[model samples]
Target chain A: MSLAPDEVRNIAHLARLAIGDEDVPAHADNLSRILELVDQMQQVDTKGVEPMAHPLEGGQRLRPDEVIEEDQREAFQKLAPQTEVGLYLVPKVIE
Target chain B: MFEHTVAELSRLLADGEVTSEALTREYLDRIERLDSRFNSFVTVTGEPALEAARAADAERRAGRAGPLTGIPMAHKDIFCTRGVRTACGSKMLDSFVSPYDAGVVERLQSAGMVMLGKLNMDEFAMGSSNETSFYGPVANPWDEKAIPGGSSGGSAAALAARLTPAATGTDTGGSIRQPAAMCGVTGIKPTYGRVSRWGMVAFASSLDQGGPMARTAEDCAILLGAMAGFDERDSTSVQREVPDYTVGLGQSLEGLRIGLPREYFAEGLDDAVARVIDEAVAEYKRLGAEIKEISLPNTHLAVPAYYVVAPAEASSNLSRFDGVRYGHRCEDPQDLEDLYKRSRGEGFGDEVKRRIMIGTYALSAGYFDAYYLKAQQIRRLIADDFARAFEEVDVIMGPTAPNVAFDRGEKKDDPVAMYLSDIYTLSVNLAGLPGMSVPAGFKGDRPVGLQIIGNYFDEGRLLNVAHQFQQATDWHTRAPENIA
Candidate 1:
């Protein structure tokens, strides 16, 4: 299916990405191609086939809830783009 | 010395013929002198490598040298290396030094392997050509104008150029195998869950698997021994005892049943590449193996299903890189939404953004059933295709890629054309089975790879099969002449 520029903008918005007006045509072209590529799935008859989430079909391995990790916030925050006093500093969401 | 395999370097160290420090220094010098042409490494940890080599030598003096002691290799930049930049070949993480080591790095480091440094890769392991790498595209050592197939291109290039004896590579749909084929090296992507994914940056979570890239199957076996194991940290990591991959190296392929899927040999395969693969199969037959023509009817659908599934997971995983906590940040964002959108917009490349948007669209309301669920159903068919093929044969044999490495920038603009490059290798990842590419022969000056696919957790058997082939042929030993 061909994607309109507005549809492409909607997707970028939903994906939290910013596509410039000039880049929309390129995004529309590539995304449409990819969709076209994956559209081959429509030819296959998957009647009654369950969605395969895992390659091995094994369920997620579980462990008891416990503290397996130490508090390394300071060490981890060292790479943060903006952190202040052990807290990540992001743009305010509310006034 | 630079051309020596990992196993050879280990032997040299064991025989007291050379010190680890000397070997490391020799490799460092080569990287310093020659790597400029290939652009294989993003960071060369010369000082740390020398320090580790000295420590390895001291261990030898204390009679505690391990089998892998003093052997030097590189980690694909995708694997987090504590205190070192694990850029994953993107400008996003170019300045981010991981505070913790990836599971693969921890294992290799504990095995007494001296790390040369982090190798370059396609940004976030997204592209087929390594051109997506913010550091720059890695040059195929065979021909400077050609690409080393990616997203593990840097790892393959380093091994082919003899800049490093071995390197760690993660294959989420042929990243390990394709690059190995293009660069004339050997690489294996173990069954999904056979290797821990913890600390290895996520691509397609279900498809991503870490494996070894080396000069020979034997070296890959040795490194695989260290790299594969159940890690509790990775919820998806299988709980299974690791096998000694080398123990089966000398086993005869006499009675081995090799399957050639009819679908793999259909259209799109280059004539020259198919001819080499046919020769490799003939070699296996000569080694007492039997070949069967089987059908993986859903093979045509694999690339499409993969494009859907991989991107879906990648979109979710990459959402973690919103510029606040770490990685690339946009300067002076107007507000939270702007921070989220612009940081991601500026940080990611076109391929990555395209995938994220596609994934988001597929997963969005009203489209989920048509796209994501439909893709998953096709995924089952693809996996079942492999399952049936495996039942008829011990392993599947085919060309690692449709063609040899194309010239750099040839398909850089065409996303679909680039995606087709991994068609042969993608299904294995889809099935979460073990796969490897061994040096089969050359197409002109470029190498063609013989892809070997094994059933789940049958990595040792696959390595043994590759080992038998290497023993019979000198193809894997043929190094790039300029580097050699």
Candidate 2:
């Protein structure tokens, strides 16, 4: 029911969030309490109960295979942090 | 004008007694003067609202105005508004201006409703209190020291303060109903897909639903008619016809079977709030409703189940907020990983970061079954409990929150304590049923909301029930003193 500091660090990494060394203890404490709260669910007998994903009872609706959306590269790219030549700019991945 | 309801204003506009431009100006001026104390609005569209109001007046001159034409309203900051800043009450989106209008905004605009501005909310629609908002907490109009329940806190407070006659809100586990109750207003969260979520920012996509908040159920009914419908853009949008919510407002509640879940009345409920709920039930009985004691045995598991499920979904949805595309970006990055991490870390508030971490841990390898899967299975049990209760009753009634609004920072340090405030309201969201909160009475100076829960897509009946109660009671009519 408790999260260790290393575990919190791992979670932050997996979530792609940067947490400073000072904030880890607070996060570990909060996450631990939340886990303890959610830990109450373990007491219930859910042996054969199905896991509910979507609330409604139906599969996703599939649209016909046709191009319907107009290209708005310029309009959408206007809101991006960084972009160049119709591509979102980011730290270089290639060596 | 400040005391008038949306229905009343609509009538005035229809009668040619007042122009939409003048009405819009009065509301904008009131918000400018009074909203500093409440911090309800994030952005005020003064110039654009005037233009829209002028257009509405032109439409009326052309003899082509609908019931809601020329009525001024505000949207929760979560909805995307073209050319307007839609912050979603987060530092991450503080500067983000959307390129297109949300489905709800588009519908309301087409109905001839003028937009006043966007209201504030908890960051990414998380948190029970409005304190988590980067823009600052919304003050409860009834008691300026207390918190307005959130993430629809701004909408509720704005209505309570008479700053706006109508405002849109979203509910992901009691966001709409709780705030409405705390602020002593009326709000409804329609069936999960009753209103389209095409451009509404996703927090927990499965549970997040948009609805209307106003001073009276009749007003909510009017706004709901314009806001609810199917949109192909949202895969989860329900395809059923949206009945005229206003038409059923006059339906008699005679012989209505009302259920009171035993669990909801037990344990942590405040005694004063319980008294208010009891009085409300008696009023319903006088209206010829038959009250029955029902058992939703899995009620206690809602908070735990929600913590796991909502955060798990939010973690996946919010991953799109990296530095590369849109949202906040860090100063410098040695690598792509650093960019994403620092940008997200600096952009998100403490509560948001906490949820992402919890979600990451829950969905991480090796722990998925014990946490995520178990939570989902429990969610089924919770929903099944409601299904059984609804079989014996037409609607369920209870307190919207455990207690009235608490002072800001009272439960801020303890997340579980804050989560428990929503215990009585969360189960309805889990079941994807329509739920509403109406001003039942007051606890001392603060307000108490009586929650009404209905079966799937039963929004019309729910609105009727709230509307009938509003007809008999003056609680919904009472506003905070000095608000004008």
Candidate 3:
């Protein structure tokens, strides 16, 4: 149930987070403890039990396909880190 | 004036004893003078609040005013406030001013409540104590050395200190109730989807619910009525009509079935808190409530299950903050991966990063079934436990937290220890049942809350139960010393 430093690094990378080398051991320790705590769930026999996702027992409410929201692109993009005329500016993914 | 409840303030405003503008100014001044000690408010919107108050006064002059009109209240920093910074107590959103209002904020504004400001909370509503906040921890009003239970710590502290007559809080696993208990205020986490989640920053979508934090259940009733309702924008919003929560305040608790969960009282519960809860239960019995000892056998599993489910959802929800659209961005990135990593790494605090990592690990390939699915199955069992209990009792009662507020930094380093504080309250969220924390009595100077859990969408009954208790006891009236 213990997470190694490499495993902790893998988790941070998978989560798209950067952890310092010194912090990795602590992260590994903490995550391991948390996993140990969550391991208690393993003791319960949940045979034939359905996994509950949403709290309410129903499908999501469907609305008409018609668009209702007014375009707030400029307003929304105002808070963005970087944006062109319309498109968000991010680091180049392709040459 | 500072000590008046929202209900009392509403009465005062209606009777011309106080003007909304004056009340707004007084609260703004109090927050300005007193909030330094408690670190309750993250932002105080004084000018806009006064303008809103004047507008409320005008509406009153025009004979168009509601019960909550002109009443000033703060929002937990989690709610998106238009043109105001809605930090969610995160460094990531430190500079992110929201473009629109949350559904709760919109509805409350429509009800004519003046906006005081945004209150501090655990960063992204992640921590049990407010210490996780980027704005620094909120101090309990009663004992400054003790922690105000969070992630709605600021809201509770502000209410207890009388900085605001009313405030809004969101609870995803005891955020509102625990803090309310610690600070000796009243707060309710209505049933899942009872209040709209639209524009409220998502931590755990299924369990996250917004409710009122005020000095009394009567005040909470007034606030909750305004906050709850079906919103077309929130797909999960219930289609049911929001009940007039104030109507049943005077309802007798005669013949009420109150179930005491044996699991909640067993080991780990503080003796003084148990005594306070016992005294409160005895009062309920005196008021004609039939107390029955019941068992929610799966209660011990709530924390472990929640640690899995909440963080899992939080990871997915927080993925939107990739530094491309909004939130904090790194200074200079060599590449996209670097941008995402450094921006997130530098932006989020330790607890948040730990959760995101845990969530990432849980939802990762080869582990989903073992972690996430297993937790969800345990979730069903916990919910079933409540379902069985509800069949036997009208409402379940317990201590809101294992113990009263502890010293600041006491459990900060130990996440597991901090998680255990919410053992009694998290199951209600897992069950999607309405729950509330009412000031029962004090443990030393710290307050103990008697938690009342009701059937799904039965907020009115929960309010009535808390209201009846408040009517009988003076605990809700006891304010922290030096707050005045």
What is the number of backbone collisions in each predicted candidate, taken in the order shown? 0, 0, 0
Candidate 1's C-alpha runs over 4 A off are none
Q: Which pairs in model 1 have colliding backbones? A: none
Docking class of 1: high
- Candidate 3 CAPRI-style tier: high
Cα deviation of B85, candidate 3, in Å? 0.5
Q: Encode model 1's per-residue lDDT on B189-262: one tens digit a residue.
A: 99999888999999889899999999999999999999889899998888899999999899999999999999
State which candidate has the highest DockQ: 2
Candidate 3 residue-wise lDDT, A1-95, digit = tens? 99888899899999999889989888888899999999999999998999999789898878889979899999999999999989999888899
Q: In candidate 3 chain A, where is summed lDDT lowest over 10 consecutive residues? A: A54-63
Over B1-484, each residue of candidate 2 has an lDDT whose tens digit, in order, gives 8799999999999999999999999999999999999999999999999999999999999999999999999999999999999999999998899999999999999999999999989999898889999999999999999999998999999999999999999999999999999999999999999999999999998899999999999999999999999999999999989888888888899999999999999999999999999999999999999999999999999999999999999999999999777889999888999999999999999999999888888899999999999999998999999988888999999999999999998999898899999998888888898999999999989999999999998988999999999999999999998887
Global lDDT of each candidate: 0.92, 0.94, 0.94
Q: Please state the error at residue B103 of candidate 2 in Å.
A: 0.3
Output the TM-score of candidate 2.
0.99
> What overall lDDT, based on C-alpha atoms, would model 1 receive against the true structure?
0.92
TM-score of each: 0.99, 0.99, 0.99
Better of 1 and 3 by DockQ: 3
lDDT of 1 by residue, A16-35 (tens): 99878999999999999999
What does the interface RMSD come to for each candidate?
0.9, 0.7, 0.8
